[model samples]
Structure formats: C-alpha cells, structure tokens
Target: MADRGAGTMSLPDDWPDHANAILALNRMGSFDWDLDAGLMVMDAQAHAIFDILPEEYDDRPETLAVRVPPNEARRLDATVSQALKDGSENYGAYFRIRRRDGTQQWTHTQGYIRRDETGRPRRIIGVVRDATQELADIATRRERLEQDTALREQTNVVQLTTAALAHARTVQDVIDVLKDTHGLTHLGATSLVMGLVEAGRVRLIAEGPAGSFVAGTDVTGIDEPYPMNEVVRTLSPRFIESPEEFAAGYPILWPHITDLRITSAAYLPLIVQARPIGAMGLLYNDRRGFTAEERNILVALGSSIAQSLQRAMFYEQEKDIAQGLQQAMLPRTIPSVRGADVAVRYRAAAIGGSQGRDIGGDWYDLIPLPGGRVGAVIGDVQGHDTHAAAVMGQLRIVLRAYAAEGHTPATVMARASVFLHELDTDRFATCLYAEADLATGVVQVVRAGHIDPLLRHADRSCRRIPVPGGLPLGLSAEFGSLEYPVSTVELDPGHTLLLCTDGLVEMPGSDLDDGMRTLTALIASGPEDVRRLADMLIDLAEERGGDDDVALLLLHRRGLDAPVGGGRLQQHVAPGDPEALHEARHMVRAAVHTWGARDRADEIELIADELITNALMHTEGAAIVTLRALAGGRRLRVEVEDSSSALPRRREAGESGVSGRGLLLVDLLTDDWGVEARGGGKCVWCEFDVPESDRRRPNRRR
Candidate 1:
C-alpha cells in the first residue's frame, strides 16, 4: 500500500494480511488521550466505529463526550477517575456510542495510563472493538431458549385444558373446568373470562375468583365500541398492551378494566369450522408484548376451546327432543304374561351422519290375544329421520287395531301391510308378528320381510327360523298382494325366542352373516335372565362402528324345572257371553281362598267384573281373566284381559245411567289398578298383598 496513514506504526510489506486479520475479528480501533490537554486522537478504525469519516473526526475530549450518551459518558469518567485514583495502570469499560448513521453501537475500550517522573499521568492509549454483532448473537440465543420454554409451557396448558373439557356438559362446565385449571396463569394469564355467542347476544359463561362476574349477565348492548366485538367479528386475536390502547379499543369495558386494575389484555376468538362460536379473554396487571409464537399458540387454543363448547351445546339440545318423543310413544313397563318371561330393550343412536339425535322408527308391542295367548310384534321403518318416527307411531296404532280385531297373524300382517301402502308416507316398514299361546307352548310367526327370529333350543342349540312371507309392509302394495304364510314352532319349555330389528346385527364394513354369527354366539353363551341378555345386546349395539338404532324383544318359556309356587288359575271368556262372568267369579273365589287372601275376596271380585264387563261390551273379542298367587300365597293378583287397546279413563261416576264407572270401581276396590298394554290389547290388573299382620293368620276368612 502507498503511505499507510500518518501517526501509525509501520507494518510489514504484506498489509493485506493485517487488514484480513482485522476484518475476521471485530474491527479493533485505537485512540490516544493526553492527560494535560484533555483531548483524544482517534484512528480511522475508531472513526469507522462511530460511523464517521476521517474528516469528521476531532481530537477533543468534549467532542468525544458529545458522541457518547450521558449515561455512558458518566461511566467513562467514573472508570478513568477510579483507575487514576487507585494508581492502576489500566482502565476498561463497555458503553454505547451514537453514530452518524443514526444507530447506536456497543463499544468496549481498554487503555494504559502512562505517568512521568513527577507521578502525574502523561498520556492514555486505548482500543475499541465493536461488539454489536457478537453481543446481538448472544442475546438472540438467550431469547430463543426462553421462547422454547414458554412454548413448552403453552403446549402443556393446552393439553391440560383439553383434558378438562372432555367431561364438560355445558357452557358453565367449560368455565368451571378452566377456572380450576392453573396452567393458564402459568401462561401469563392473570385472569380469564369465557363468553359464548347465543341468540345474537354475548352471554358471560363464567369468570374465575368467586365474584368476578354477575350471574346471567348478557353483554348485548354497549354505549361505546369494545375490542371483544372486534375479535368476534374478525375472528382474530388482539393484544392490547397499555391502558390507553385498552380504553381506545374497548371503551365500553373501561369500568371493568378499572375495577380489575388491568394494564394489558388479550382477546382470542374461538372459531370452530370457520364459524365464530365465542371468544376467550385474558387479563394482565402489567403491559406485556406478545411474541408471534405466543399469539399463534393462543389462536390454536381458541379453536380447541370453541370445538368443545359447540359439542356440549349440541348434545344437550338433541337429547331433550329425543327423550320427549321416546317417552310419549313407548310403553313404560312390559306386561306380566302368565307362562312366559318377557323383556324388551330400545336403543336410540345419538350420532348419524346429518341426522343428529332423531331416534330411528323401531318399535315392539305386546298384545294379549284370546285363549291365554300373547301377540308380540317388532317393526322398523326404512329410515332414521323425524318423518320416519312419525310414521312409526301411526303404524303402531294401526297394527294394534288390526290384531285386536280377532284376526289371525297372517290377516293382521296383511292388513297392516296394506294400510301402510295406502298411506301417504314415503318410507317402508318391516314387521314380524307372532302369536304366543303360553298355555299351549305354541308360537305362530308371520313375517313381512323382516329379519328372521332366533330360536334357541332347550338343548342350547340356536338357529334362525325361516318364514315364507310377502314384501315388507309398504312394498307389498308395490310388489303384489300380501302373501304372508304363518309358520308355527312349539317352545318345549326352557327354550328362548328372540325378535329384533336389523340394527342389532349390522356393523360398518362387515357382512350381515358375520354379525348374525356373532349374535348367535352371544345369545347361546349368554345368561338365561331376559333382562341381562338384553343389556348385553344393547352394549353391543352401542359399540364403535354401530351407527343404527336397535329394538329387541325376548320371550322365554319356563320349564317344569322352574321352582313351583302355589297353584295358578287361568280362564278364557268369549266376548258378549254373560255366562263367562259366573265362571270368572268361581275362578277368583277359588284363587283367593286357596291362597288364604279372603279379606280382599269381595274387592278383587268386583274389580275383575268391571274390567271384563268393559272389555266384553266395547271390545270385539273375548274377555279373559286370570288369577295368579305370588310370594307364597301372601299376595293375590288378578288380570282381566280385553281385545281393546283403548285404555278407559277414570271419569266421574255416571249421574244416571249405569255406565262409565268401570275404571273408577277398579281404582277404588283394589290395592293397585292400571292398564298394561299386552296381546294387542290392555290388561286391567290388580294385586292384593296381605298385610303384615294378616300374612301370619292361619287360613282365616276375616
């Protein structure tokens, strides 16, 4: 190089090496200060450090002080004075200096103070290295670790909140679980409030700390704009870091902000499936700047929170309507038959694609036929919609009417099939009708294209019974005349018969034959009690991949091995035959006195008379009465059967004529009187249990 600058030490001929060395390391610049003159001489490197040119450099202490900020200048003076006072040979300090490029640079200088023979400082020489890049790299690494830790903490908070939300049942449950979750505070949330959008209004779901919110407060209208509305409208998170910003964006919430002493806050919008369901708000006592990563985490948490809240609200609303419809249409208790143990189960699916909570149109009915026989029927409409459910209810009424008209199983099935075909419904239904003669151990089955009934033999072997029948109800009209043929099977005591809809044996992505085999195995290896068996089947129907509703009916025949009780009495009285009343009276007297229930003899006799009389006069078929003794002769029960499904109401006693008081008489003369739906009709039955004192009397007629 030509003339390597004046007032500098002479370097080797290869000046490029020296320049490369300075460039590789931090640029080291030198300065000299004269103790007597109070001035400095800066090198070109030092001038570059100050973002200055050689022409702009000045050798004056005041000039250097002007470049150094007040704080750093004071630091410089203190360091140099202490070094001189302590008689130290060296002084060093790190400070910031203002540059001509409008940037501040971190600089560190170390100097040696030389003294003369009089013990006074003569001159000072120092070097300054710009540590800006190195220091910035160190700071960046530290901040990254902190951010990593915070992100982990935020992820943990989300996991904890998600676990708590699973068991939440309502919007309030969402708030309660969140309040109990302490991870939010760890994520810098001093306080939190959850709000839900409902009916065009913002309803406060819950707030932490006992008295944070008023009960049932709807923040619907406000005099000034609020940041919460901005979040909901934009579906974006907002971070307000100061009181002025909070007041400016949420003027309506200023009072609450003042009460909370809030200096900063965050509003994260809860969006689910691109729909804004609500928002979560976090409050802080100090202004905090949110990093991009932190805001991103909060946005994800908002989505999760919104998903859980929406799921809960939908479940609650759907269940209410389903339960109401089920209660109104279904029979409460299974009728007590004389020779068969009967059980029924119904399962409604809560989730079906597009069809939320509408229960499928699957129903089973028990009808008490003439001659001590029971008529059982189970049917299912083709679809699982509200329209299908309504159609099912109407079809139940028609089936009951036709069966009670003294028709055979085939006739009843044919009429019901024709009725549905003539109706205005767009769906079809499948049905299986069976007349079970408990007295004769004989069952007659008429199928209308429904699933075949399962017959489990007393020897523990199971098989499906085939029935030659016509098309499913509505389809019979479309295809041809109802060609239903009755099939008969005798239950040799200890045998079980099962009837169900297709839902019980259908699984996603599985063959129907496979489900049938599985069900057969379940039935053969299961318990004998009808109720327990029904429970197991219901569990199977609700397992994963089972998306349809199920309706099941089980009828079992008691073998002679069944434990013997006191004697039983049963009779059949043909309709419009007055002479059958005398026979019924004789049967009741023998049943009551045989069981030693003489005290309620007159009361039970009158109760049976009214029930049979009403049935014979209004109903088309016979009125049969049965008396059975239960609990070792301590309780006497009477059942008067009719071929009418219409239940008689307890009305005011007739003023003049001897009519309309049948139900009232039964109600007043018996311990219990109610109409049970069975055998395509109703059973008006009464039970007279002996009092504690009377149960011990030995054959007394008191």
Candidate 2:
C-alpha cells in the first residue's frame, strides 16, 4: 500500500477482490480520521454521501460542518468522545445532515477506534450510509403500535394520580400529592400551578418549583386573561403550544414569566358533576405541544383532583362543627385551687383509625370543693361521637355538684353512676374521682371501672395505686352494684397525683398492667413541675397515635411553707367500744415515734389518750382522733374531735384523782393547745415540740 494523495490511500496488495464493489453496492462509504494530524481521508463514495465533492472537502474534519448542522455535529462528537474515553472499540449514531439542495435527511454512521499500545485512541475507521428510506419504512410499520403504547402510558399516569389522590383528606394533602416528585412531576412538568374558584375569583393556592410565582397572578378575576382564569371560566382546558401564542393571549402574565422560557403549558379546568370548581396548569419548558393522549390524561386527572378537593372541603367543615361542639361541652377554664398546682389536657384520637371520630367522649374537670379540698375528675364515655360527648358533659356537671356538696368520694361516684344510668342514651362511662384535702395531705380516690391513678412521691418515684372499682357508670346502676370503694392516698408536700382515662394506659395487644408500668416509668423520669409533666405525657400520646382519646389531670401539692417528712394518721374512737379506743391509742403511739418525736412519744401519746378519753366521756358519740407530724418533724400535733360543742378548759386536778386531770395534763405537757368549732362539734388539739436530733434515732426502740 502507498499514500497516493493527501486525502487518499492506495489499496493493499492483499486486499480481497471486489471489496470496493461490495461497499459501493451497499451504498456505504468509508473514511479514516487521524487524531494527532487532525486529518480525515475519505474515499469518493464517502464524499458523495456527505454531499461534498472531493475537491470541496479538505482533509480537516471541520470541513464537514458545511453539510452537518451544529447540533448534529456536537452530538456526534459527544458520542465518539464518550466511546473513546470508556474504552469502547466502536460507536454508532443516527443524525440528520443537510443535502446539496438544503434539505435534511437521516444518516447512519459506524466507527471503529484504533488505539495505541497505551490505550490512547490514535485513529478512527468508519463507514457512513443513507438511512432516510429505512427509517421512513420502519415508522410506517410501527406508528399504530407506538400510539397504543403511548395511550396506555398516559392512562396509567391518570390511574396512579387518582390512586394517590384517594388518600387526600384535606386540600393541603391533595396539593402535596400533586407536587411530589413521583407524582405529576413524573410527567415532565417543569412547574405546577393550581387555583381554587372562590367568590367569583380564581385564587392561586399553589405554584411551585421555587420562584415561579407571578406577582399579580395570585388572585385573578374569572374574566382575567390568565390561562387558569380562562380555563376556570370557560370550563375547558387551554393548551398553549408556543411562547408567541402565550404572550399574545396573556400579555400581562407573559411579561412577568418571560425568564422561565416556558415553551408550552396545559391548563385544565377542575370539573366535578359538570361544574367547574378550580383549575390547574402543567407548565413545560422542554416540549412544544401535547398529543391527544396527554390532553385526555390531564383532563381525567383534573376531574379526580376536583372530587378530592370537594371531599376535603366537606371533611374540614364537618370537623370544625364537631370540634366546636366538643369544646362547648368541655370545661372552658379550670378553677384555681389553693395549695396545689393543677394541669388538665385533652387530645382527640387520630382520624381514620379504629374509630375515626374527631370529637370524642374524653374529658377532664377540676372542681374546688369546700374546706380546702379540690376534686379532680377524669372520665370517658363508651362511644366516640357527639352522643358520648353530650353524656360526658352532663355527667361532669352532676359529679362536680356532688363533690362540691360535700359528698364523699364513694358517694360522688355512686351518684354519678346513677345519673348516667338514668340518661336517655344507653352509653356507659368510666370515671375516677379524687377528693384531696391539701391542708391535711389526704386524697380520697374512687374508681368506677376506670384505670388506677398514679402517685408520684416527693422523691420522684412513681407507682400505680390500685383503687377498688365498681362497674362502669351506666352499667353499675343497671347491675345494682353502685358501691365504689374509697381508697385513701396520703400525699406529702411536693407529691403529685395523676389521673387520666384508660387511653393513656392501654396500647394495642398489650396488657393493662404492662401499660401502667410503662406510664409509671415515664412519670418517674418526667419533670417535677406538674405542667411540664402533663405536656410531656400528652405529647407522648400524640406521638403514639391511638384510636381512643386521652384526658389527663395532674395535681401537685405545693410545698409552700409545708413541713418536710410530715405524716398524718386518723382513727375513730367509739365511746363504749374498748377495741376502738385501743386501736386509737396504738395508732397515736406508733405515729408519734415514727415521726422523729421519740423523746416526746410518751407525752404526745398521753396527751392524745387524755383528749380521746375526755371526748368520749363528755360527748355522746364517737370521737375522731388525728395525729400529725409538723414543722419538718420538729413538732407533733394531736387532735380529738367530739360531737358536742363543749370547749375544753384548763382545770386544776385533785391531789389524788384522775377524773379532772386530762385537760390539766394536756396543758402541762403540751407546748400549745387550742380548741376550734368543727361543724356541730369542737376539736381539742395540742402540739409537742420535738428536737430535730430525735429524728436520728434507730429504727427500733426499747
């Protein structure tokens, strides 16, 4: 072989016979391009295929730009460069080239790379051929099949959009689904614009892909020239295929969005039941037109969106009403109780769960009772509807009345049960009532088929107090078992009592005891402030997302000037009951010693016994004796209340007698003494000052 000319190479001696004839017969021409020399050698047939004469084309590859369009040449260069960089041996591509008459025709090319020993491409040998007729023939054969495939794909997009819209419960939810990346964005829309028809105006509710909003298009009149407005007013879709048409039709909007380079857009009216509710627009920057299939898909999706929006509107409207009713039924403000910190919270259940009621029967109330007592109530009606809420309101009112009327905890619960049973509806309710005397640190709890309450000690340790219970409010009266047992919990200063409906103590598939243990642990680790602890618990319930509503009440006894390590014990002493008197004496002695008053135990016990004896002797009824440790265990107080209103007076005792020496002994051995009118009776109380060092005594005494 020899180099015959600058752009030619002579055939080799070992070349196969008729090789040139074979290539010519197939209308293929060959060329060789040198990477280092920047030269391309083409045969006569190759020159003809490129619509250039042998003399017109120089050996430089750039000369081919006369026949190849700039876009096509760049595309080809990219294909070849990628193949060379990726270590590919060959590359092929179809591109359009301008013919001699300035008409473009499809051309196909195949090239093989020749690399040096180091894998650096040095040359490329390829063949080019005319592919215009071949492509035209294939397009004719597959046109119908392609159309059907496109239609199916468009229809599938509609189905997917509708399925996603099915879960939209609110207007914002529908907007989210539409704007999601895997949603309508998958259809290659560069921007989405949506508007609702409100009061004869098109209100733009959503428009995105950041910075796509036009300033004055937020709210447009129905007669405005905006595309969305046009579609909504006409109840028909408007497809803008070109920027010129858009600018001509919407001159006001086009000037504002000129920088977006939008080439086409489809604005569809949101129609349901033959009425237009809104409009949506899908804007595209890369395409110039929409096919019939695409138009149909967008219209169908618009219909689905319209229905979803209507449903969401109705849902929100109903929810507002239900929430208003529930709020009206619940207590507007919790009455402040002295000597205690109180917090109450209510959380509605998650919608679309087991019972998708946005308004529930859960409720909480705080009632200020007489004599420095506060009543805390938590209850839940059987159902999760307005009926349940109505019943709960009535029950709450009656329960508050009973508690404020000085009824005992058990009686309050029993009366509430009877009231519920007498209601016209057949609903049952679980209730827990606690009457707490903050001054005395005693809480009387009554439970009727309700979860046990939690007690948080001053040390932050928490435990469940299992108060005995009767049936639910309505069921108890029906079954003739209205006895709600009273459980007394002695709360020290800084101690808190937690009352809540079972929703806070019941998880799916878990035992009630297990849930209680979890709640106890949570409370133990919670903040000491009652308000913060209540917020934390309610937040937990919100995160758990259960089907039942929750009602919580937290009452923390304030530590204002309260003695530390104080305790109270009460016992009844009957006039003629020897056993009652013995029990009262034993209780007084034990409490006095245990309260770090061991040095004065004898005097305190003697004072308490003499007071009890005087009350029994002077009064016609039993006496109530109460022993309390006060002043941070620095003092012990003894109280004996009798049915008679006679106040005890200091009297002298006979030298050898015991009958008149009770008050005299109480006066001599006590640091202070007083008598107060208690209802129809009088209470004689005495205090004994004990040294703080006595608290360090051994656990047992001789």
Candidate 3:
C-alpha cells in the first residue's frame, strides 16, 4: 500500500485478492476518511461487512453514518473527537450498526489518527470487526451465573430455616425465629401471618406487624373471597403481585388490603403429612412477584409451620388434660361448719410467664373427719410436666384414702410415704396434713418435707409452725410405714391457718424461708374473708412469677360464742360392748341437763345411742364419743369416732333384721347427722337442735 494522493492510501490492484482473503478469515475490513478531499473509501471487504453492494463504494461519512444507530453514532463521534484531540495513535470503540438488510450487528471498530506537521488531522483509517456473537455469548454466561447464584441462595435459606424449625415446638415459636438474620431477611416478608382451620374457618391465631387482618380474625368459607380461606380450601399457594390483582382475586378483601396497606401478599395452605391443616400467609409493603425459587422455599416451609401449629394445639390440649386430672384428684368443696371457714387455691406451673403447658403437680384437700374434726392436706410432686401431674394425682388419691381411714395426720403421711415408695414411681412428694378440732381449737400437723404452716393469731401476729419434717415421700423410707413427727398447735377462735405448696413462697432469688416470711407477713395483715385471703396470698406470690404450681388451703377458725354453763365432755367406749351405747346416752343426757336443755334430753339421748351403736357395730375397736353444746347450747352435737375404716351408710333395712335404721333414726332425730372419715376408721355422728337458749350468760369455752 502507498499514498498515491494527499494523505490517502493507494492499494495495488493485486492487493484486493490478499485483503479479501484476510477479511474472510475474521469478518473484518478497512475504511479511510480523506478529510482534505472530503471523501471516504471502503475496501471490498468493508462493503461486504456493511452488507452493501459494490455500487455503494463512494463512501462519504454520511454513507456509514446512515448505518449507525443514532445513539451509537453520537458515542462514536465523541470517541473520535477525543482521540483526535488527544492525538492518540489508535483507539477503538464498540457500537451497533443496522445493515442495509435491516439487521443490526455489533462491530468493534478501531481507528488510527494521522496528523500533519502542524498537528492537524489529514485522514482517518479504521478496522471494523463483527462482535455480535461475542456480545451474545457474554450475556448468556451472565444469565446462567445469575440462575446458579439464585439456586445456591435458596438452598442455603431452606437449610437454615429447616434447622430453626426443628427446634420450634409451637407455631408461635416458629414464627418468632423466622425473623432472625438468615430467615425473613431473605424472605423479604414485611409481615408473617398464621391461619388455622378452626371450626370451618381460617382463623389468624398470630401475626406480625399487628396489621393485615387483626390477630384472631376469622376468614370464612371459599365463597368469602378471602385469600386465606381460598388457600385453605384449595390447598394451594396464592400470589398477589399488585394491589389490583389482590383486589380482583379477592374482591371482598379489597378494602381490607387498602386499609392494611398491603401492597402485595401471599397465601399458602399449611399442609402437614399431605393433609391441609390451615393456611399461612405473608404480606409485603411493595408490589412484588415471588421468584420460582422463593415460592418453592415458602411452600417447603409450609409443612414445618403446619406441624408446629398442630403441636401447639396439642400442647394446649394436653395442658388442659393435666390440669383437669390434677384438679379432679382433689376435693371439690370443703365443709362449711360452725367452727371453721375453709378455702383453697390451686394453680398449675407457668413457663416463660405464660400459664399453660407445664402442669405443676400440686394438690390440696379439706376432709371432714370424726368428732366434727376437719382434715386438711397439701402436697407437691417434683417437676412441672405431665409425669409429675400424674404422680401427683395418684399420690393425692393415696393421701385421701389414708386420711379417710381415720389415721392421725402423722399416721396418714407415714402410710402415704410407704405407699408412694412401694409404688416405685421414682419420684418424691412434699406433703402437709392437719386435723383441726373445732370444739377444742386444736390442730395436729404432720409434715413430710413440706413447707411449714403459717398461723395468724387474733392479735394479727403471724408465725410458721416449727414441725419436724421427714424425707420427701417416694425416696428411701424407713423400713416400715414412714411416720413424720406430729406437731400440735392450737388455732383458737379468730385465728387463721394457712397451708400451701412451695410455689406460693418460692421465687427466683428467693428461697423457701424468704418466701415463707413474705407470705406470712402478707397473710398476717390480710383480710379475714377466706376467699379474699386466698386470692391475696396467691396474687402476692404470683407477683414475682413463680416457676412451680401452687396449691393453697386457708381456714379461719370461727370466733366462739359465750357458753351459758354448757358442758363439753368426750367419753371413750370399749369395743364389742353394748355398754358403749348406754355410756353415750348417759353422757348426752348429763350434758343436756347441765346445759338446761332437759326438754330435748330424750331426743339427744336417742340420737347419741344411735351414733355410738353405729360406731361400735361398724368397728372392732373402741369408739370415742364427743358431746358438745354449740351455738350457745341451741345446738347439741354427738359425734362417734371409731377405729374402723368401714363407713356406715344409711340404707334400706328392708324389714330383714333390726339395726339397719340406726343412721335413719339419727337423721330423723337430729337436725343434721353425717359421717366423717378418720385414721384407720370412720365416725357416724348426729346433731340435735336445742329448743331453748339464755342470751345473757357469761362467755365460756365449750
């Protein structure tokens, strides 16, 4: 090549063959711009690269400019101007050109700037190469990389969420963990909502952001047009990418969406083990589409969420069962009698400040015993789960059985300890038992590794009874029946007796002693209303939120009235002896005459004879008779305590033999007569309504 004209290259005629052969190898050719001549020339290959005929050979700048897209032409012009100004030897740019055939091609065009001695441009020369294939290849690779990256990210999210969901025991627990770093962060979920199919409706039990249909709101049937209900019915996933779509898809929910500011939302059925349990939902603040991968991830999580929701429901139902079983094992009501008022409170254990799930094994009982005596017991088994509650239930039945057998408090606990130990439950229980005699104002306590009793006297002074306690039942016991030491304390008139499980007093950062002191002080200055006092004590104990279940028994000794020379006497009679009946009658008559109630002596004697006779007949051991003048001698009570566990019940004597009518006769003779259980025995007792009273007499102990 040589310059035959001003600043232009001239090629030999043979150069065409070599240039065309090289251009064929690389889809490239050469072009020249002769600025001084104001002419442009293209090689044969350049003409073919532009997809033009040979007649297009007289190349002016406009000739190539016509093929360049406007945007590419401007960009090329800028690059050329910069190159010329910078006086660069060569510079290259890539741009798109539309061929004469109306097809676009990407060309990599590089040009050289030739300057004269005065640094002025003479001619421009450049090479044009087709780059369309290269550009398409790069784009293909980029798209493939993006897909792989998306797949990896989704896999990571699924792995992390599955691990987290494994530890979630409840639906709420699962929901709470999803917002942690790796979870909802990738989900882009502004709100997480859970819907359960309850009673033929989709109910939102829990939600996030506290919006988008209130928590616990119900979505009705498929005809309702709620996305949640639709998902539940169809067992499929719903995607509303825009508010308009949502409005169209769920016309009934359009206003709700607007009110909730839900730009986009999704509803997916919560299917567990291939069964549709409910629907789960998510809400977003921006209108967005769920990626195929993202929607798949949510669908996978659907199973886990459904399982967790079912688990939470099962947990609650089990808690109900445990609590119901625990309560059913205890007394439903206690006696309301002349000398005492009783009340009880029982609460299961709490977990994380929520009251349910873990049922504490605690129990309380107020049993009516022989001789107008009432027996009270409170106990607790270790732990706060179903097993503990079951053991607590069994142990409660054992305690009641023992207490009803006419055993003393110590005797009952001893027998209970042996029973639990021999049963091999591998558990332990702390128990307190007390029998209070209303007539004498005496309370006998038996403790087995239990909290001490709180006694608040008439002066409002409170003290914990110092009873020696034995080991907790079900651990190693003494060779025989495990007997705890009996401690006696007089609960006089106007005194309050408090017995409770450890949960009442024990709290975090506080031990049994600290809790006892706090409880004692709280009850000491509290009101005398048995119900009120029970509530106050529990409220105070629950103030710090204990971890254990609590059972509290409260009894206030009724204030005694002034006795008007009425007598109080108890006689012990021998077993298998008819003389026991005679002795009982004599004692009743003597008390009736002494109390100026001789007008009722015959009735009193008759009732006393029946009670003692029943007791003696029903027992092989001795019978103890107690006669008391109550309500200012307007009420006479004759109680017979026997050493037999057999409780005498009134039945149809049926004209067979004599003596089946003993309780019947007493029931008719006395205002009231009922049987009370005692240690190893039971008592058949009767009360007589005294006909007369003198109100002006001095007050005395009956």
Quick one: best TM-score, which candidate? 2
Candidate 1 C-alpha lDDT tens digits along 162-242: 877876665666677676746567677778887777766666665645556633344753121555556777778899888
Q: Residue 265 of model 2: what lDDT? A: 91
Models ranked on lDDT? 2, 1, 3
Q: lDDT winner among the candidates?
A: 2
lDDT of 3 by residue, 370-447 (tens): 555688888988877777878887888888888776777777887788888877577788888888877667788888
Once superposed on the true structure, which residue ranges of model 2 sit more than 4 Å away at CA?
1-132, 140-150, 352-355, 562-702
Per-residue error for 114 in candidate 1, Å, reads 30
Positional deviation of residue 204's Cα in model 1 after best superposition, in angstroms? 7.0
lDDT of each: 0.75, 0.84, 0.74
Compared with the true structure, model 1 gives a TM-score of: 0.54
Q: Give the per-residue lDDT of model 2 (tens digit) for 1-702.
A: 124237564333454687677779999888877778878888888888899998898777899999999999999999999999999998999999999898998999998888889999988878899899999988976897887886776677778888878888778888998898768877878889999988999998898778888887888899988889898878889999999989999898898887888999999998888888899999889989888878878888888899988887777776777778788888999988766789998998776622244878888999886435688999999888778888888988898887765566887888888898898999999889988877678889888888999999999999989898889998999999998888899987889999998888899889999999999999999999999999999999999988888999999987866444355788988879999999998998778766778888888878888888888888899999987766566777777888888777766667876677777787689999888665567778888888867877754544
Could you report the Cα RMSD, in angstroms, for every candidate shown?
13.0, 10.8, 9.1
lDDT: which is higher, 2 or 3?
2
TM-score of each: 0.54, 0.67, 0.64
